[model samples]
Target: MLSEKTVKDLIDNALEERSDLFLIDLKVNPDNKISVVIDGDNGVTVEDCMFMSRGIENNLDREEVDFSLDVASSGATSPLINTRQYKKNIGRTLAVKAKPDLKFEGELTDVDEAGVTLEWKTKEPKPVGKGKITVNKQAKIMYDDILEAKVIIKF
Candidate 1:
């Protein structure tokens, strides 16, 4: 078990120190469990997870607490799932292949708790009945959902 203040402080400090790895959010659920979400650099690897886990565990252990831990990285083609993730990706181009087999690539222009706005331009003429759509940010993904995402550099 862990105290909220303690967990919050630990997460905040770690996120601050390793900002290159975006600290999306943290929560101590009602079940008294701690959950951490982190967004990493484009090339985050297994080593990154190991580093974060050790850092978090080391600090928490020092406080005389025990808990289960899990750490992971954003996949090369994972969809941006939350406002925090989308904000971190602002100004970076995102390519998303949505359901119904639509492929789109665009600059991330805005993000909110509700959804995200992408400034996408297609080389071909617009398809019939194809209108601009806003995709709500999901906290997690399922296998059936289709999406491919990556950060593209644009000034």
Candidate 2:
């Protein structure tokens, strides 16, 4: 059987050559089907995926492992798992689900080592008035508190 560690090492070496890319997921089934998912700071392209696939394929010996490999980029709507992903998406809108059933939909304004800040405007009742008012709101969500986060693609 093909070892996962060996495959991981191969991928790590490949990523070293492409500093902008990062690994999102890797799976090796019992039947030796390896699936590699990758993402990039500036987003992933088909050529990037091909490069990664070749890096792995060129290193492995087909006669010895008899394995199949599939390399793909993380989809645009996929959940953001890495902090770098958040940084690249700074100006885009995101839908975030946090702890305690908290949910937020807003533009990602900032990202730091600790968390991200989302900003949006909403209509709310005025503090001492009879009518509603447009209020700007922001939320800071730490990485630990994030249950899921996805980019909101606008058409």
lDDT of 2: 0.95
lDDT tens digits by residue: candidate 2, 1-155? 88889899999999999999999999999999999999999889999999999988999999887989999988998999999899999999999999989999999999999999999999999899599999999999999999999999999
**lDDT of all predictions:** 0.63, 0.95
- Report the lDDT tens digits of candidate 1 across residue range 36-132: 6667655467776777777777787644655766667765456666455666777887776666676657777776555556675434434556665
Error of 1 at 47 (Å): 1.8
RMSD of 2: 0.9
Best by lDDT: 2
Residue pairs clashing, model 2: none
User: Which stretches of candidate 1 lie above 4 Å from their native place?
Assistant: 29-33, 76-78, 81-117, 121-155
